[model samples]
Target: MRAMEPDRHSYISGVLVMEKTKLLYQQMYSGKVFTWIHLMPIFCSSMVRAQIQTNSDSKNLVTHKPTPTSEALSGVTVEPTRKSRSDSERPESLSKDLFTMSNLSVSDPELEKPANGSYSDVYEKYVLPCIAEFLGTAFFIFNGCASVTENTEGTGHLQPALAHGLALGIAVAIFARVSGGHMNPAVSLGAALIGGLNIFLLIPYWAAQLCGGMVGAALAKAITSDVKFFNATGAAFKSIERDEQVGSAIVAEVVMTAYLVMTVCMGTINKKSTTTLAPLCIGLSVTVGILAGGSVSGGCMNPARALGSALVANYWDYHWVYWVGPITGSLIVGLLLRVFIGDQKIRVLMT
Candidate 1:
């Protein structure tokens, strides 16, 4: 039996090696699944406050009434009144991805039912809307780009795609009521073309969004790991070197942006109960775009985001592809929706 000792030792070593390999793969899979979830705390501050409160009209936020143990003799009964959607506000706008019916509803309000009613009054009345856009865009850029900063190969678009999709959904859920959650300049322009937004407000939304993107990108650079590698790579969008063509890149961007903008417009058309889940749909559209276009044009539907990263890294490789492709696609889709989709004539405040 002494001669067999070496064989036993070899078998034990092989088993140990197999276990270690399995552990490594498990860790990698977990990282991909939870990457987007972990980024939530990094950029979710302020955007989620008061947005999730179920009772919009309730002055009090406290829900505590009595503990089960403390009220053994006489239990305290607490019944909270729930607020339901009213009829005064029904037909929602096309620019928004989610559904809201209250006067406080920040998604797309009608052209006549501006938060302040008239461009002149918007500055004082709904200035918070601009700030909402700023913060929303910033959060998107910071979290979304964080993944791209690490995914230099572009094949790892899976992580970046998931990050961007989930980030946009959360941002929209929190800020859609205030600013219509137009994180992309392309989205704002399309909404403007469709008469869903004030024609004059488009530029302002663009500026705020762009500024947010720049600040978010800069802040992301400061906080993320491997700054040297990220900076060296410039974190700019590039076509997959092997099979990328200028025409194909343009088409990919145009198609993906079209899908995104179209989903936003159609998702809120008072069609289904799922309208309230517009944020998820819009986010999914972004994910789908990345899946379809990441290899071709970096799947950049937002020019502001592209511009922000380009400025930070001083990298402009095929930068125009982002702007031109998304813009063209958004314009065409907006006009198509206007001509064929029919007027919505939405109400302002919920009853």
Candidate 2:
């Protein structure tokens, strides 16, 4: 038989008696015999009761263990008896305890929250999402710009189209949970219009996207040779050569951006049309835009991407086309959604 285990009450009593005896022993050594005599009876009785409780607990454990034949016949495995522990001491509570200790508040429906929250809420709500957006956009711009500068012959538009498309798709997929994967300002605008994004977050999201673009463009410049950078105009828009082409280029930008944003709205935001392949569809939309409009307007559907390269190249020629065209396209999509195509909850008309 296993050794006897102590029960809670008797174990507590034993602790008290041990403390009392420790103090009595010191007093007895110090010529305080009367103090020891008074404590001895209480301490001995507590020890006897503790022994009895431990024996009873041991008997319970022995009785609870199933016999081998009974376990086999029932086809069930019997787990060993364990000492009862508080919720905090259980394995399942470890992560919750860690979250509490680290000051990261997890959303618990049953738990009451304070009206005025602490810094952790702000960090989770705003700071982290912006950082994700920044990193995602930066990586996207770096890949697209680097591919443009490389400009391997015979590849023509294929390289840049695939580069930008694939980069955007991957970036969106990675950051979607945190920041909704809006690597483009046009897409962000569309999302805001469709109620996919908060209106207040537009400014901060735009700022982070622009900053990420700049960093990504800078990184692309650093990795490529100066000659290549100059040859490609630092991946800036150089297709529109004549004044007359400005209108055509703007139309091209508007059409292509609208196409991309429309795909984003339908694939990612519209509940009825949304699918798990949203990231893939969105990427393909960019690919198609670049393939179709590459020669006309450089297919720069994202203002942040355009601004990054323009800043690095010092090329402001028709730079406004990049911003105005995409923004106009986004506005058109927003109007269309409100009037016709948006989901039921967000749609304003025909409800």
* Best-matching candidate per lDDT: 2
- Per-residue lDDT tens digits for candidate 1, residues 163-229, read 8999999998898777788799888888777665677778888889999999988887886676653
Report, for every candidate in turn, its global Cα lDDT versus the true structure: 0.70, 0.83
Using all chains and alpha carbons, the TM-scores for the candidates as numbered come to: 0.60, 0.69
Candidate 1 displacement at residue 244 in angstroms: 6.7
**Segments in model 2 whose C-alpha atoms lie over 4 Å from true places:** 1-116
Question: Which stretches in model 1 have alpha-carbon errors above 4 Å?
Answer: 1-126, 151-155, 225-228, 240-244, 269-274, 344-351
Model 2: per-residue Cα lDDT over 283-305, one tens digit each: 99999999999999999999999
Weakest ten-residue segment in model 1 by summed lDDT: 90-99
lDDT of 2 at 320: 94
* Each prediction's number of clashing residue pairs: 2, 0
The prediction achieving the highest TM-score against the true structure is 2
